[model samples]
Target: MNHTTFETPVVSRARTVERLVAGQPTSDGAGVKLTRVLTNTLQRRLDPFLMLDAFGSDNPGDYIAGFPDHPHRGFETITYMIAGRMRHRDSAGHEGLLSNGGVQWMTAGRGVIHSELPEQEEGRMEGFQLWLNLPAKDKMRDPWYRDIPSGEIPEFTRDGVQVRVIAGASHGVPGAVQRDQTEPLYLDLHLEPGARFEQTLDPALNAFVYVYRGGLSIGDTAVPVQRMALLANGGDTQGIVLQAGEQPTRALLIAGRPLNEPIAQYGPFVMNTRDQLMQAVEDFQNGKLA
Candidate 1:
């Protein structure tokens, strides 16, 4: 008698796009025109993530003034440049210049005052600012900053897909930015026409994809530019799969472990309780935040 060995088929868990969000126009940071992708209206908060803004314009009038003298606390801010340059200076004596393909990761734990201005006078200024929430335990830890140049960022290419890892691992390659609390996954992906990209993620983490250019197929649904695809809870799923349209496509894929704690936020401060929120305000007003 002859016996044959059988192989088990691998099952890929693809998170379904729960909803499609059309970015809304909003002016922030000294008359900067940007599209707000994830905001308070979108489910109060997305666990460890707070907000995402896509800002870009060839016209100088749209983004020249830039963000001057701002205060933040209890969270983190990530600025990734795509087309232009931005200079960041904070009260912690931290200064960074984020040019094309550069990144600035700022953690305003206790408190921080900073300013972000364009490094150029006339040209295209384009970038994305992502707000990541800090857990209550880490909220009052300490302020820190990480400046990553374009040349330092790790980029992985396979077939027709290119992935730039900023805060997590992709294709077994780790990113430059690191956070022990959140353990977030942030990837900038570009795909050629008809290309496909897939990666497994922590099943307990919340994830989403924001399309910035061209179109893509997430699962079976089609997503266009300036739109966000919120993923369902991983549950039994293993990973996410995406396919590009006829044209090239670009997007940001982010995921993080959910804190599952109460959130109290006011302006630039995000705390655990209303009293903490008020304290943050008082600290800033009393010039104690630095």
Candidate 2:
């Protein structure tokens, strides 16, 4: 018999919130209203993470048309639903429904065309879409998709704090969605009033937190809904501590290993160089990109 043991080092130092950026109101994909939290203008791309968009609206007029067919390559798209439902159909003949608490991870390696539309005619629709950059070597790989339901996602609770592990380990429990290339961490945290949550992270990775509900204090700095806090590099220490205010709070913690490579982006195509970007354009124009 063989035995394996995993251990996480205890670090006393905590990573502090470096900066806060307010989300910008924007519209995209057949006129769906969204708040762009992270954009190229913010930091000229945050290593492996390209963009984060939060789409939430109770009025059907704000999101009725939904995202029409679009093509993408050399990256991945992650859709996590907090409310309502979205139906997705891709060129690879894959279809999925992302309901409240559901998630869809789509890897547009070489190319892919997809559409996301609301499942209901009227009501609330709310969710997030994140774009992750792929390494140059894996840019031309085959497309892949992973759809995970809310129940399948692992959750852990302790001391009035609950954490849903979406794409990495939390409290010794691993998430359902794992990608070998980027090795990202996505966590949804809910903190009861006056509760505190803490976690250790990889020092080499880039990390950020997005507050969606209530208020939280990140190392003495107060953060509210629709605001994003970018964390400083851990350096010698790789831990973060967050405390909830009087009201209950909800936030997302995301981190990813940095690729540290040149980026060339054009609309839906992201590549390593101008030539590659031009090739991607030609591929889509000739119908080679699906």
TM-score for each candidate, following the candidate numbering? 0.94, 0.95
Q: RMSD of candidate 2 to the true fold?
A: 3.2
Look at candidate 1 and tell me the lDDT of residue 236: 90
Global lDDT of each model? 0.87, 0.87
The lDDT, on a scale of 0 to 1, for candidate 1 is 0.87
Q: Write the per-residue lDDT of candidate 2 for residues 111-192, one digit (tens) a residue.
A: 9999999989888899899999999999999999988999888886777888888897766777877777678899999999
Query: What is the overall TM-score of model 2 with all chains considered together?
Result: 0.95
Q: What is the lDDT of residue 62 in candidate 1?
A: 89
- lDDT against true structure, model 2: 0.87
Q: All predictions: root-mean-square deviation over Cα?
A: 6.1, 3.2
Off by over 4 Å in 1: 1-11, 43-45
Q: In angstroms, how far off is 207's CA in candidate 1?
A: 0.7
Q: Which 10 residues in a row give candidate 2 its minimum summed lDDT?
A: 1-10
